[model samples]
Target: MGHKLRLLWAAYRKIVYVYLLLVLLPACALLYVYFHKASAELERQVAESMLRAVEQVRINVDYRLSIVLEVSDSLILNELLYDNLAEPASGYRFDQVMEQRNLASLIKSLKGHDILGIKLYVPDDKLYAREHVHFFGLSEARAQPWYGDVMARSGAAYWVSTRPQLYGAAGEVQALSLARLIRDPQRFERVIGIMEILVPETNYAPILSGAEFADDAEAMYILDRAGRIVSHSGASRIGERLLPQPQFAEMTSGRSGILRFAHRGEPYLAIYDTLQQNGWKTVSFVPARAISRPDWATSFASPLVLILSFLLLFILAAFLVFAYVTDGMVARLRQITSRLRLRGAETVGERIANRRGVILRLEQSVAHMLTTHEQLVADHYETRMKEREAQLRALQAQINPHFLYNALDTINWMALTRGASDISRMLNTLAQYFRLTLSKGRDLVTVEDELNLARAYLDIQQHRFDNFTFELELDPAVRECRIPKLTVQPLVENAVLHGIQRKEGHTGRLLVHAYASGAGYAIRVRDDGAGMPAEQAERLTSGLQGAPGPAPAGYGLYNVMERLRIYTHGRCRMQLDSAPDVGTTVTIFVDRLPER
Candidate 1:
């Protein structure tokens, strides 16, 4: 028996090792390949999303400046200002004191949200400075930095905010100024002066808002042609030249698109585009790891770990079963050979040849020892009885409760202290989910309790999903309102399974919003998933009671509707609004509930 056991153990080891090689290596390789693909795809989506946001910022900036451009276009149409600055205004022909009033009126006509100050540089400086209007000499225009660019523009307009002296209100007053070269066509198109219109920094600064990607750490900026920060969420950064960045060369290369590079030894993604109106770059800078790790990578890790863990358990189980079966067969061979030796049978067939396989020799020896049919039948019956007894014990073990809840509590504690807080949190949430679900078998539950159950379910799902996120909003007044116990959970499940999971590429959002309406309340479950058509959405809201067979599509929704109808005495109705590729929104409008 001992020798036979050694043979079985050797074969068991071979099979186990071979099976592991077959399963583990391939699974790991496939996981690596798929993970690479998913990471690349996720990074692309993040880049595209960031690019669109930055592009929107650019459009906003362009739109604001275009409004100012319109004011410039309207100001250029004023012939009186051009005539006033054409040359020294006739002191006898026009009121010298009223020339300031005349210029101020021109500034007022051109004034809107776009203009704060208008400085006209005249060669013959006769007029003094006013609140909105200022007259300077050709030398004054030469002193300004953007003056050359405005002159180089020839007949076109130019916008400059690169330096402080460019502003009429010293350097302290920061504003985007539009400069246009005023020319006299009647005087052979000779240069008259430079027209400068000032727009306060506060105007477009708020349009940058607080928009960011991934988190607040990710920054969005409107940069000038000189690489200086024009408009930023942080006001202090305005006019400051952005510190030398590695990608600054690539970004300034004038090809507006996405690029990736490392900053400070860490990877970063830069999505930049040039604004057409101002020729400024809108850069949305984000950390590369921030865009990838928290999303799908987390989703992959947990599932991969669970699968590998199960594979290990399976390998162990395989070896255990192999050992168990081999022990029984080898023991039977020993019993047969011992009995034959006592009965004087010819040494239980030929002496086991080492040349033949161990299994083959054992088989032949057992055949000779069991020559009598009666002894073999007796051994078989005994072996069957042993197996039956073992199965009965295993059955009892499986059915026994063994204080499952207490075991879970022990596991929760073990996970918590060992720095597996995530596991502990998931286990606690799961336990709470079950407790809330049962609710002591109560049918009606407060809106708050129902939302808690939904939240618990979503929290657990969040672990498995990397690209998925959800929000739960409950108005304080609606928390006490009672609704069906399991209503919200099923809806959330439907949204996650049908909506978020089915969504292709990019993050999925599930929102459960509950609030008081008029005399009653409303519950909204929305998902940015692969939304269905209006007809399909309408069909989904219909209860399945009259259907011929099981309709898997609408079953969960139908149950919720029926439960709500019965619980609220027909005071509630569910409505669905959905559009293809846009999203789905399911609203439960609850009428006034009767007092118990």
Candidate 2:
């Protein structure tokens, strides 16, 4: 057992070495080069896509902000509010009411589904809402920081950033506000009040969280100059400050590009663009995994899995190509080895050294050696074919057909001269037998001639032995069909010699029948005599003997089968049905019309 295991291990090691050298090493090197090149190209594409996505989001934010500016412009341009609000202490009570109505109407016209509310704080210390104006002290308005900020940036818009607009003690909502210092249209310089639009953070969520970038984007937000998130995809981060802000020095540096950073141990790519309208930055955060992902197949597979799959396919394809070539060489080598043995020679090494040795030197060299061995085997095969043909001609020369015909004719004349009826009939049958068997040396003959040959042969056999009787039932439709000569005669001969002659104490009967069955013709020879056992019957059809080496008998049957197979190219089939003490029936079926 140990010796066998060691031999197995040695063979396994040899095969593994060859496999690694021929298949695995080359495949791995190619795969490595391809994977790196593909990964680099894929990363560039992903970065470009992310940049485009971020640019698109920035464009959308700018467009929405322009709409807000348009609304602010519409308010300042209205003559009714400008006339009444610019003169703070005019005290025209009816005009103030009319101006309040006009301001309410303007806010109603500009407000959309995404708008929360609008506020107009007049320098008169009065806040004009939808219905009326609420008076407040001028000192209170001047003390507010946002009020002072709006005053400082007169004639321009300012972002108050994101903050929670508290409605009640228990209710609060995230809102993004834009405040503008409303000025008198006549002076174009005198500030009247601060006009602010408070909008829900949800209004800009669609622009920030564009569906096209959903696969990779983690977040999108508009950041104020102070690095505070004014508008974010999720309302929860609307008022949050970006901690550890990246490229803070470059944020207002008037440059726009992508930035790579890690957050909470997770890597991310930040694509940002500065908005000239508000001095704010629009940023889109994309996860590193998403940026590194290639396509559907590679994206779904882990990096390890993708590398392993590439290796597996590479090795499998290389091995398949190698094995296919190796199998062809191995088959040719086996054929050569078989031929050498038949010629009473061993392998190439044995022939050269007069001793046994392994035919293959190394796995890598085996294919080349086999190819050269095949060339030698081809020459040997040609010589053997010529010798076999010569042997066949010599065997044919020993059977002189003309001399045998003449002898049969002489015997017939003698039997007739002696007035011996039985002898004359038997001699005539023998002459017909020899004539049909020869058939002018033609291998194929009409079915009628074949049947006649069987009939004559059987007649001679029955005449020579009176223990058996025979009957012939042939279909006329198939009698003209061509068949191999002496096809039916051999079966009849077997029935007489092996079947009937073996029976005892009773007379035997032989039946020879030929008929059309479906698209083919069946020729059957049956004998009611001593039948063979199941094993012998099986061996008769299968051509397998109980032991190795040559069969002791049954050469005629096997030869007939081989000839039929070659003549029909395997289209014809033969079957044997028999049981002990019953009878034996041999049926030959030819499936196609005979050629010529």
**On residues 425-522, what C-alpha lDDT tens digit does candidate 1 reach at each position?**
88998888877876654567888999999999999988878678899999998888888677888778878887777778846898999998888999
What is candidate 2's TM-score against the reference?
0.46
lDDT string for model 2 (65-133, tens) is 766765665565555566667776535666666766776777778777656766676665333432223
lDDT of each: 0.71, 0.67
Q: What's the CA error at residue 439 for candidate 1, in Å? A: 78
The model with the greatest TM-score is 1
lDDT at position 514, candidate 2: 91
Clashing pairs in 2: none
| C-alpha-based local distance difference test score of model 2 | 0.67
TM-score of each: 0.50, 0.46
* Alpha-carbon runs more than 4 Å astray in model 1: 1-16, 91-94, 129-133, 165-171, 216-218, 240-246, 252-255, 328-596
CA shift of 559, model 1, Å: 57
Q: Candidate 1 versus the native: TM-score?
A: 0.50
Best model per lDDT: 1
In angstroms, the error of model 2 at 498 is 99
Please report how far candidate 1 places residue 489 from its true position, in Å: 67
